[model samples]
Target: MNNAKKYNIKIAIAVALLLSAASFTFLEKQEINSKDNLMEVLYALGQDYPEHYIEKPDSANIKRGYELIHVGKTKSADGIASKAISKFYTCTSCHNVEREDLDLTLVDQDARLEYAMENKLPYLQGSTFWGIVNRESWYNDDYILKYGSLVDDAKNSLKGSIQLCATVCSQGRELEDWEMTSILSYLSTLQMKVEDLELNIAEFEQMNSLAESNPDSAIAFIKSHYLSKSPATFAELPESKEKGYSFEGRPQYGKAIYELGCQHCHHAYGESDLVLDNSVLTFRWLKKHMPDNSKKSIYEIIRKGSYSELGHKEYMPNYTLEKMSHRQVEDLRAYIESNVK
Candidate 1:
């Protein structure tokens, strides 16, 4: 052959090999993606898959649900306004609609505090409503202690739990059929996505490789990354020494918790009779009561929240150790005491 012909043949052969390799790689990726729809994987693993989960929820239902959650009322399809679900508290009073923790796996309050401050979300007593749809159970752990017989029905059934919260916990009436459907549709929109998983590159590759042959391993691995249920362990008020009274609390963090956690229901136009603001009077009252073991003290009120009485249907929900740490409670104290006039 001529020298030019030999060179052209070599180039053609190399190009063919490259194209063949690229095609194989593309096919491999396509196969992986087909199997790696985490939602399907979770469903196959018997992960409490909903009967009907739509990728896109109905916009009007979502709007009504959102309004109901935030304001305790919404308009029906006919443009008629529904009655308030609760006169005292809306869903947002104790729960944030957005994600609170930076890492989904860790329920660490400090990390959650940082994320809440960064994202401008309330550091609430209840778990965030962001991924509530994906969670297998609700009103978990020591919540049974407070709810008593009510928790029995709600422990496993999402709809049952929603009704429990609406009627018992929130002191509202039982939700109507349409209202229940709308709220659930809204929650379904908040289901966890694949990006929320903590898979490393190597782990992702392993899952991709093992997807067909050893799929159970990948399923279990994904499940391990996040909790199916939020834990709630109620704690007692700390003793004087264990309260970390000596340690200087971070006022900046404390301020965020106060505004986001406390003032959400305790400010002017908020749900609480004991209104809280930047006013000197509020600060002074909190400071004066801090040394005592009264409900007015942050230490007492936070750990041992008030319960509903005959006349008082509205009551404070106690913070779980998982929800608010001892340090964060102290941080709240520092912030309140700092503002004392």
Candidate 2:
């Protein structure tokens, strides 16, 4: 080949390489800039995405909220205590503060039991407060039947629901405005982190790609990954004497439900007078009285929870099908039988 042709070919290849390097640099810069947008988009669409969340929660307010939830009262820096929120129950009596299920979309009792065991938390009736701020609805499903007209006002409003729980559910008075603000501020701090979504690589890429051009689609996509609201369905007590599952129940799993779910409210430091420890007597009592039509039976009590009378304001909340499955109840029976034997 001619020397002039060879020189032209070398120059062409050099320009191509330089252009490729410049393109790579530009793409890297674009990705870096989009990182912030990625977080914004994820949080907007992620689980527990409340309509409005405080970006910065006040530490003082958070402490007050914490105290109110665990203790049902707030204390001043000077150590004076505010009026108790409830005579019967604190928020922690029924609700957990952390995530309960492996997947936010799942409402399985077995999975929740496992989660509780893992996290050292008690299995309770109410949903967790971890993402309460993000939930669009509250006091859902059968709650309407219990609360009646009150549910109407609380269903769509978080503040309303809080008030309903405080007055009716907790058997407490209405919260002061500042108290409400502080509780909300504390809940805001519990917003789900981006990592909680567990987005895969391709999903992360899609999120990044749509972070700017079409955020609505991205938001919908992420929302689809987790439940926007926890569901509740009441289960009727079994008609016949037999309530066991066809398959054998796992006594180990049932043991957890007994300890975390039953013992949580029955033992010392719990809400109930009935003391259920790791005793053979408790097991024998459960085995003999297991799940009949009687309200004292495990099955009947779980399905049709007892109502509070004038003398007792604190009452057991019935477990929804979503909270405790038929299989789980059978498992509890199996556990009791095992202990009795």
Candidate 3:
């Protein structure tokens, strides 16, 4: 198949892990507590972004996320909070959300039949992609594993491509990149819904079975069922009140600016091993290389960008930076000074 299609198959398999690593790398040392301000998180991300999204992540992340999805980009928002809603804990964990393990009724098992059919293949070797993503114990795909594909004989042409990608490339399919943006948007707009959400399911079921029980208890459980994945309520979170970093008061206004703008992809705050200077200065590899500028002259390589797909793997979007005001740029410069010196 073509390179784009090949990329699709590969991305489908391990997109989650890649996205997780990419988003978490900056915060590798920080905890993602529920209490942290969304703007703080957004600001930090703006600063440490992969250079592809340096200018404005809220705008860029959603925009880029949608672009990928429109073209069948699959890996973008797998790690976005809306899709995850706190991992491993089910509604039964607290009744604030929903049942313990997700209702089996909601799962589609078609991928399983497809997998079983694959085991019958003699030429279908193994997968490096699977080695990375598959925990080995869990089924490859819950939905696909349970139900078989509904492909007709005429559409069988797509089968070889799918099988080849799954076996050899090891890409996964589920949350597409574009869906990630929508998910992020949902997360960005999140406000808690149900208040007394937790259900005493046992109490609930018992009440339902009783001839005369507290109507309120039954009402509570029924109410909780609908809010299984309700994120922390808007009331619980201080974020519902619009909060932004005030530029005038903070001593580290530069840091705030950097967090809000430059830190995403460039090595402004600290030198990273991935980027290069005019002299191609890297720590050890180009050991003796020299440059004339003792003072680092920073410039916006990508106006709205952090990196380039044209060739630079900077991951920083270029056009986005063009939107910045001059004061913001100077603020970023001052922020970098603390790290630069």
The top-ranked prediction according to TM-score is 1
Write the residue-wise lDDT of candidate 2 on 296-334 in tens digits. 688878877777779988788888888888888888888
Per-residue lDDT tens digits for candidate 3, residues 89-180, read 11111111111112211221122212322342111111111111111111122212212352221122222322222222222233433454
RMSD of each: 14.2, 16.3, 22.6
Q: Which stretches of candidate 1 lie over 4 Å from their true place?
A: 1-38, 44-48, 51-56, 241-247
Clashing pairs in 2: 48-134
Residue clash pairs of candidate 1: none
lDDT of 1 by residue, 235-270 (tens): 867667235454578888899989989988888878
Model 2, position 323: C-alpha lDDT score: 86
RMSD of 3: 22.6
Output the TM-score of candidate 2: 0.83
Error of 1 at 180 (Å): 1.1
The superposed Cα distance between candidate 2 and the true structure at residue 192, in angstroms, equals 0.8
Q: What stretches of model 3 exceed 4 Å from their correct place?
A: 1-251, 259-261, 264-297, 302-314, 319-323, 337-341
